[model samples]
Target chain A: MRRQNLALVMTTVAAHGPLSRAAIAGRTGLTRAAVSSLVEELNTAGLLTELGSLPSGRAGRPGRALALSERGPAGLGLEVGVGHLGACVVDLRGEVRGWLRVAADNRNRPADEVLAELATVSRRAVTEAEGTGLRPVAAVLAVPGLVGEAPGTVATAPNLGWRDVAASGLCAQGLPLEVENEANLGALAELWHGTGTSDFIHVSAAEGIGAALVVGGRLFRGARGFAGELGHVPLCPDGPVCACGARGCLEQYAGEEAVLRQAGLAAGEDAVRRLASRAREGDRCALAALERAGEALGTALAGAVNLVDPEAVVLGGAYAELGDWLLPGMRRELTARALRRWPPKALLVSGLGRRGPLLGAGMAAIRRIIEDPAELTVSRSRR
Target chain B: MRRQNLALVMTTVAAHGPLSRAAIAGRTGLTRAAVSSLVEELNTAGLLTELGSLPSGRAGRPGRALALSERGPAGLGLEVGVGHLGACVVDLRGEVRGWLRVAADNRNRPADEVLAELATVSRRAVTEAEGTGLRPVAAVLAVPGLVGEAPGTVATAPNLGWRDVAASGLCAQGLPLEVENEANLGALAELWHGTGTSDFIHVSAAEGIGAALVVGGRLFRGARGFAGELGHVPLCPDGPVCACGARGCLEQYAGEEAVLRQAGLAAGEDAVRRLASRAREGDRCALAALERAGEALGTALAGAVNLVDPEAVVLGGAYAELGDWLLPGMRRELTARALRRWPPKALLVSGLGRRGPLLGAGMAAIRRIIEDPAELTVSRSRR
Candidate 1:
């Protein structure tokens, strides 16, 4: 009961904080005494901090406003993309205190070598965060693959040539770790910081395409946690054979490699960037390539929309970079194909872009502390 | 609090009943006095009945079991299909007390005329149910189109030539009426009585394909309540143009008319029945047509499965009748196209088949009473 009340108070402040004790009591229906006690415990834990006093309308002394502390336990986010590695630290206020990104050709590379590099990057981020007086409580790693039922395992990452890789133990030492699908993390980022809808679809692209569904404000992982394989949904039953042995998958048309190939560019780290610049310069081949990819994406999304009926579709990752060129064809195809009285209201480009997964990973870890502050308080007492 | 306890007792009996009063109290965490009082009120409301005594192993007299009533406040289910109209009554025990179905080519038919016929059919069903000592509380009409947000309105049912048709007022007068999409109801019926999985896709077909999603034991209606329009999902992309003005829709390849056309059969009320018989007899053209249609259905469903990742796919409505012919092609395409490590676990034919929509409509009405028996009891007191 105490833990529950603590969580209720913590969540109340996290959601609508910068509040006085009286205001929190009124909002939570807890007595002012209970709120004060809870707030005091939270303050001692470094999870809450007093800000400037609120101005009282009457002449009485004003109560200090309380908000989530920025110097307490933070979240260390790590990512292993097919072509890059990233690490970041986010505070309880959802602000990034440390950020680092490095490009690497990780496809089919040794998982150990790649993870060693990631460990160095994460250590640097943690060091930077600690220098700023922010303590990272846990680390979350986002991978472009199916996260296994077992903790910290990536079941498969076709683009990375990784299978059954246990990522946490080898990467961020001294912190408890959790592994998540990159697309799922991106969708969570969109939910928490971007469009903020309770229901929407978020699609991201890198070497391969990935999509995630957020229904009722929660990630809708299908029964076996393999939902949102939009890249592999067959677009042309007889077109091209894909790496997954499917014919004419959406990836064959819209994935980074496919778009680069169609634009007559050699596959490399800067290929998508070059293609985007060429499209921006009104190059016919680049524009046509992106246009075709967008149409294929829209067609597959039309099917997804028909099935799940989300409120909006947010383009993220590489697609966000290329959205200006992609949106026209996608909108045309979606408008032509959607079986609705009205087209879906919004097709958005994610502001978080490629950074969504790493930030979402950080937020996810911070969220755990906020949701159950008792864990931190109990562990602190034990220490 | 009293109303909640009353609903708890009612649902407990409905789920685990033929249970004794002592069992109800133990399961519900209510005192024996509380259980007895709530049971008495439910008994007076005709929502529950005393069953034969349980065979208690202990000494002394055995307790009488309780179950949902077989009479009173039943559900009246009505459906307007493309080629037929149906009405039936389901008791709280989920037994169909009365059944009626009439053939009518409702396509392009006047909404008023068709509703008049439905009213007659519903009246007969209600009368027959009353003859069997059952009193219907409300009627739910299942239509083959999108039900509007407003009460009693259908936004569009292309197959039925219905647009903004206020069906509740025109049919089943004197009874509180609710309108639902047929596909949605079919999926609900599957959830209640068929495959019984909380997460599955239910696909039904008549002249056009319709599908519904059930997530966490509730129907997942998209933002606009237009989530499942599988018929219009593009399958061939450049094939035939659909009535919805999209090219290569799944309906062009998998709908009844499409299959019948491919089989060199005339379009009529009995076309599907004839095609099924011919395929049963191993006719080459019939088998080929059904096989092609199944493949198309499978392709569309593959996209859905990839997007939603349901545990099973229940082939309801007309597809249930043709499961033997459809399952093979669907399995083949799904296996070939799904991006999962393993294909979806189950693809079962619905036991309810074409009757799913009507039975679901009836069950939906009955569920409202089960969820909140207070409304029934309170209204009964006023009466």
Candidate 2:
């Protein structure tokens, strides 16, 4: 609870401004003493630095300035996808200090092998980040699959052929770690660093479709942390048998693999890239597949928009690449079906792009330190 | 800010119970001085009563037995439906002190006429509640329509033939009031008064299907308070044209009118009651209609469950009467569609029955008292 309030104060500052102590008190509704005490604690933890003076309140007195420090309690992010692996570190100010990404076919690989490779890349990123004076306090691993309830175990990543993959085995030193679905992480990235709406839906795609809900500044993880599986939401219950055995799931139409296969290309990044190029070049078959995929995704997304009424729907991951081809159909369906409301703006492309999940992973990794100044204090003491 | 903390303290006491001042300090993380101050304030407001003593922790000293008082602030609830009008008053302890219900065909009636009749009934209930020594501090009116962002205004009620009607104009005397959709009130009732889990979807149907989401012990109002219009969520993009001009909205198949038409009966409460009675008696046509409605409802609910992943899906309103016939198909679809995990319990029936929304309305009316005891103090002063 202490950390929650402190974290709120820090995040408010990070999101809003380097406010004066009085402004912090007003914004956070903390008594001046409480704000001063928390600010002092944060300063001691190297999470904040006091700047000289800024324009003050109505009294016109000079007020002390404060800001997130650049080189303390950094967050580490790692992501595993079918065709790539990524690692990054971000400072308290949310600036990327170090980053690494690699292309690799991870599908059909043994879970242990892929995890080991991810760990090796993660350590290398850590070493690089440390050189720039950033310290990783925690880690969040993003996977293109279902991350289970248990800390770092992935229940399944169908595209990666993974099951019960305890990824934290790589960082067995009890480094606070969590495995999260990539789409959720992507949404988190958008919430933390992109367009500043607290209530919105983030849609991302890879081999399968994924959507994440950000309501009231927090990810809307459902009763089982399985809240946002937009891919499986039935658009046409009796249309076609899906991999989940339910018929007419949204994934059958818009997933990257589905789109590629429909476009008469093999499954993989190469196929996706070629499909994009062909569509851009006005090839008939490729354009048709993308167009149809857009319609299906749009129709399903319209239903989602109608139900949740988020401020906007952000396209991320591979879907970000196909926005131009998808937005027209997506907009048409949403305009017709989204409850005739002015709000929940028309579809918006994710500003964070494909690197969203990796960036979001880093943000998650450092959340504890930001939320609990005490955690940062302890981290500082240990260092 | 002051009242919010006061409300939190009062709610904490109301929820947990009779803790020592030191214990309150520990539980709320407020200083002992702050807790003592808040306790004194609540005691002055007639909201808290200290009874003798209870055994304490640590030092084993006797602690005052604190509890919510019965005769302090009360909530009055009123509801307007196509075929019914209901009102009730609940004390601080959430016990119903007085109630009144009437059956009427309110369709196409002027909003002013319906609201005036509702006010007359509300006054009667208020008089009855006063006779029982309960003062109505606030009221919540439940309408079968969309509650607009403005206080006590219904933006639309297609069934009631009302639009942009500000019903609060009737209660201009300023006993704090709000207008809410009946389905939303039902879900809140289930959360506050029934066997409780914070994350569940409460589905109820009248002329149209409505679903309300309860997450973390609070209603999820979405970006614009329109989060729970499940009736319009497209289940089949091409199945049938719906009143909203969308195709295959859940309402087209599972709404009361839809089911009655399918069951070869006139559309009304009598027909619904007869359909239930006949289905119970193994009447073939009635049974078949229920089966098809359940499947259609199930398919759409499956999509909702897949999107929200709530702990349970509760049936209320008229659906409670039809649950016996609808559960099988609903459960089957949910089981097949939900993530392959241990979550989202099978379909549940509302124990609160048709009265859930009214009860919930009462609770909402009094939420201010529970949330901010300062308001109670202010009310008492004005009196």
Candidate 3:
């Protein structure tokens, strides 16, 4: 119970910036004495630092404000896309300290080679922050496929050409690690920090459309921990064949590959972003491609509303930059096709976008540490 | 707390035949003393009656079995369809005591007139049970549309042509009454009394594909209480127009009207049953119509799996009797189109079938009484 309270206190502080002892007490509904005791213990553990004293409001002495200290530990977040891996070093308080990105297709590279490259980049990031006295407390990797119900293995990653890979084991060589789907992690980031805090669907529309469901402030991974495979549901009986050995999938029609192929782009994130920008600038070819993508997305989103009936739909990943041009058509389908009584609300572009996976990975590590404090020591390692 | 225990004990006894006190204790995880005390209190309340001595397992004194008293107050369940309403008087243990059906269209009849007809039928059913001295303790109405988030109003009933109609109030009339969607009630009945419980989508293939989402032993009504509006979602954008002003809804393609129009059957439950019988007898036209309906249903189910991803999809309502002819095509679509990593299991025909809504209404009343014991009262009026 005490540990639960401690976790809650730290999370509350993390959520709402710096706070005085009285403020924390009032917000958490904890007694002032209990708050003081917990805060004192946290300060002793190097998890919290006291800021300058606040001005006296009444005739008594001024109180000191407390905030998360950089001395506690830091988090390492990794996001593995189809052809790129991004990493970031964030403080225990969720503030990004350092970042790095490498472009390498996992499909062509061996798993061991990818891991070694990740290790090299991660080592560089650690060396870059050596003088700050910050330690990499935990690492979280966000991959792009359905992870199995059991934690260690990745069931399938069509884009990466990987199946049932021991992801956690590879990442957990000596450091504590957490692995999650990029879309699910994006959803977690949005649920805790973006518009759809209560319920929403976060779709990463890259090579394929990956989706995550956040219901009632919690990620709802269905039976077998493999829910939200939205891209694979058949939209057309005789439509084009999908890479998953299925035809007429939402991804086959609306994914980045489809958009790029249709627009004659290089099928890269930068190219996709450039197309969206050109479309925004009223380029005829780009406009037509984006409009077609939006229609397909609308049909898929209409299907989403039919099932989950969430409060809002969030679009991220490479194609989200298309923005309102994509949303209007989607909304039209939802209004025209969804249940009239409760059509889903407007779509919102993820503010975090590409950075969402990394931040979410950091959050996953923090959540792990808070949930099982015994793992905290395992996370603290000199790279 | 006492009422919860007593309700659990009574429900357990009702589900399984009359059980010994020790057996009840073993099943409920309640202490023997607490169970004994609850049993005593319930016996005093005349809800339970102590039967004669049970069979002695060994050479010890036989303990008396406790059973729900047949003389206890009864429950009233009503299923309000498009053009007809079915009423049933059931015992506290969910045993059907008497039944009645009324023919009237909510579209043509005034709201008050429909309510009056319902009241008249309810009064007659109550009188019919007078010989057994069973008086209704509560009533539940299962309407075929989206119910409101508010407790009393039916937000929209397209088939019934009622919007914001206070069906709950119409039945309450100074009595305990609860209103729910027919599909949701059907799912509940299947979950608790018919098929073994698991995640399933219970879709009523009626005038429209009214659906109920049952996950983790509870109905998941989405935000605004309109989760199962599957009928409104567009199956084909240009196939046919829906009465709800939407284009190519699943209803237009596979609903009762679609079946009736295709099979040239009268618009009634009997006609639906006759069509099912014809399909079973291998009538080419009937079989063809049902197959078409199944294909549309399969499309919707595939979409549903892509989104919510339940363990199984359960079919119920007016067209449930189509049986295997309607199932194979749907399964084919689901297997061929659903996410390969996490495809749902095969479809299951609801065991309750057409009678599910009736039983579900009773279950709703029972649920209400159990959730809020203060609502349960011993009426002074005789049956």
Candidate 4:
């Protein structure tokens, strides 16, 4: 309980730094005595330390300012997709310290091999941070499939041929680990830190179109933990067969691979970017392809709103850089299709951009550790 | 505050029978002195009466008993559909004492005509209950469309051809009034007293498919209040044109009109029931029609579960009478389409039958009055 209260205070301070003890008490609604006790405890534990005294003009006593220790535990975040991996190191205070990216051919590789490559890329990112005063106490890995809450089992990731692959093993090499679909993490990031919207939809325009929904500041995993498979929401029953054995899934139209396949371009991020840039430069064919993708995505999103009715939609992932062309059509189709009584909810590109999933993953890891302190034993002991 | 507290205590007693003063104190978490004072207040107010002492053989002092007065403020519930109106009178404790059903043709009628007919039927029901020692002090009206939260206005009711009808006026001539879409009310009824599932999806299958979602024991109105418009979720892009100017909405496949139209029967409830009876008797045409409707409905439900992740789905309204024939195919289709990771949630036929909407409306009214005391002005004034 003490640790939890201390952690809560530390996180509050980390989120809103260098706050006077009175301010921390006001923000957390804790008694001044409780705040002072927790602050002293955290300072003793090296998780928090006093910065200075605040000069209170009308107070009987001046308040001491406290801040999160720069040397406290950090978290590592990894996002693994079909043929790419992204890694980021985040401090305990939720700030990104460093990042790394690598391209790997995971098309036909075994699950363990792909995981090994991801781990290698992650290790390199952590090592590259040299003396940056940030050390990871936990790590979260984001995948592109339905992840069971049991900590690292992928229920399915069609593009990667992962069926119940044990994800805990992938990032559990002597560290705290968690895994979730990348889109869900992105949604979480946007909900908590990006736009501060409590309820919003997040779409990841990667190899496959995926979505994450944050409802009331929590992920709404469906009856199963696989709720946000936005890619598979049937768009057209007869259009094209999807890996999920459905046809006309929104992903089949708007995913990076789908867009490239439709545009007859090579299967690469640069290829997707080139087509988007060409469209931006008034290339009719490229514009048409993105326009088509945008329409499908927008229609699918409107269907989503008709169901969940979130306050906003945050776009992210590899194709996020496509920007206005995608958003305008999405906005248009949503306004046209959503229930006419309510005005269309806002549509905004993800503020976290490519870093969302990783940051979200770190947040998830920290959440898990905080929720189950026994699980934090090794991480805390490492301090 | 004392009156409100007394009312809550009396309602609790009515819900759970005569309770000892100590038991009431324990249940309401009020002090024994407070419970006694409130019980005396309610007794004086003619809302509650003292019962014989509880026979606590081992107790040092037997506690006096209290119960809700059978003659306390009662409530009226009405469900207005295109072709018929159903009404029920319930005690403040939600026990239905009398019910009435009348056939009327309201399709294409102006709002005034519909209100007049509704008034005729409601007055007749109340007149029939005059000698029963119960008079409704409040009324809840359930319409068959999107009822906007704006006071008095029903945004749309396609079946009745009534847009923005002032429902408050319809029921406010002689009593306090509240109105809601039939589907939303059905959900409230299920949430309040149905088999006690904490979280579930309620689908009202009548002229069109509507859904009401209960999560964490409360309704989840999407960003806009139009969260449960599952009827409009596109099922087929090139299928039959929907009334909403869309093609292949689930409603076009599963609505009452759709089933009757497909069976080559007139678009009437009797025709639909006849088709269902024949389907139960293994008539090929009826079975085929039901199967098609079931498949479309099931697909839309799968999408809904993938979004809201409710624990169960309760079918209510007119089409709910289709019985087991329509359920098997729906279950089969949902099982096949929903992500295999989460096992299918349970499906239930509404126990409230056609009165689901009526009871749900009553529950909603009671909840509104309880949570927002300002809505209870008339009831408090009567006290």
Give the whole-model CA lDDT for all candidates, comma-separated.
0.87, 0.83, 0.74, 0.73
Worst 10 residues of 2 chain B by lDDT: B337-346
DockQ of 2: 0.59
Predicted candidate 2 versus true structure: per-residue lDDT over A1-383, tens digit per residue:
66666787788788776888888988988988998988887887778889889888568678798888787678889999899888999888888898999888999999888888988888999999889888787888999888777888999888888888888786638567888999999999999888888888899988889889998899998887888889998888887788788888999888887888788888865666788788899988888888888888878877787677788888887778888898877877777777755332557888787889999999887775676666666445667
TM-score of 1: 0.96
Report the number of the highest-lDDT candidate: 1
Please, what are the lDDT tens digits per residue for candidate 4 over residues B1-383?
76567656766686676888788888888888998877775666455667788976564988767765556556778878887887777765566776887877779988887787788778777776656777666778898887766766788898889877787766646577777778888888888878688677888776777787887787888766777888877777557877887666778888877877787778764665788678878888778788888877777777666666677878776667875667876787667555553344487787776668877766665454334332344345676
lDDT of 3 by residue, A34-129 (tens): 989878767765677898986646668777878877755677778778778777777766667778878777765576677677777777776665
Please give, for residues B1-383, the per-residue lDDT of candidate 2 as tens digits. 66777887888887887767777888888998888888888888778888788777557667787777788678989899888888999988788888898887899999899989988888898889888778887889898888887887998999999999987765538687889999999999989887667888889988898789888888888887788888888877776888787787888888888888888888764667889998988988889989988888887778887888888888888789899899888877777776544233557888887888888899887776788778777545777
- Report the C-alpha lDDT of model 3 over B1-383, residue by residue, as the tens digit: 66567678777777674888888998999988998987786676556788898995868878789887776666788877776778887776667888887766665556667877887777788788877877676788888777776776678777777788876655545666777888888889888787785788888865777788888888987655667777765676566778867677778878888877887677765778788778777888888888888887887777777777787888887656776678877777777767743334457888778888878887677566544333342223122
Candidate 1 pairs with clashing backbones: none
Interface RMSD of candidate number 4: 2.1
The docking category that best describes candidate 3 is medium
- iRMSD, all candidates: 1.1, 1.2, 1.9, 2.1
CAPRI classification of candidate 2 = medium
Task: Rank the models by TM-score, top first.
Answer: 1, 4, 2, 3
Alpha-carbon runs more than 4 Å astray in model 1? A31-33, A55-62, A170-174, A341-345, B20-22, B29-34, B52-64, B170-174, B341-345, B380-383
Per-residue C-alpha lDDT of model 1 across residues B236-310, encoded as one tens digit per residue: 778899888888888999988898889999977777788889999999999999899889888888888888898
What is every candidate's C-alpha DockQ against the true complex, given to 2 decimals?
0.75, 0.59, 0.49, 0.49
Summing lDDT over every window of 10 consecutive residues in candidate 1 chain B, give the lowest-scoring window.
B168-177
lDDT of 1 by residue, A51-129 (tens): 9999755688898999999997898889998879999999998899999999998999999999999988888988999
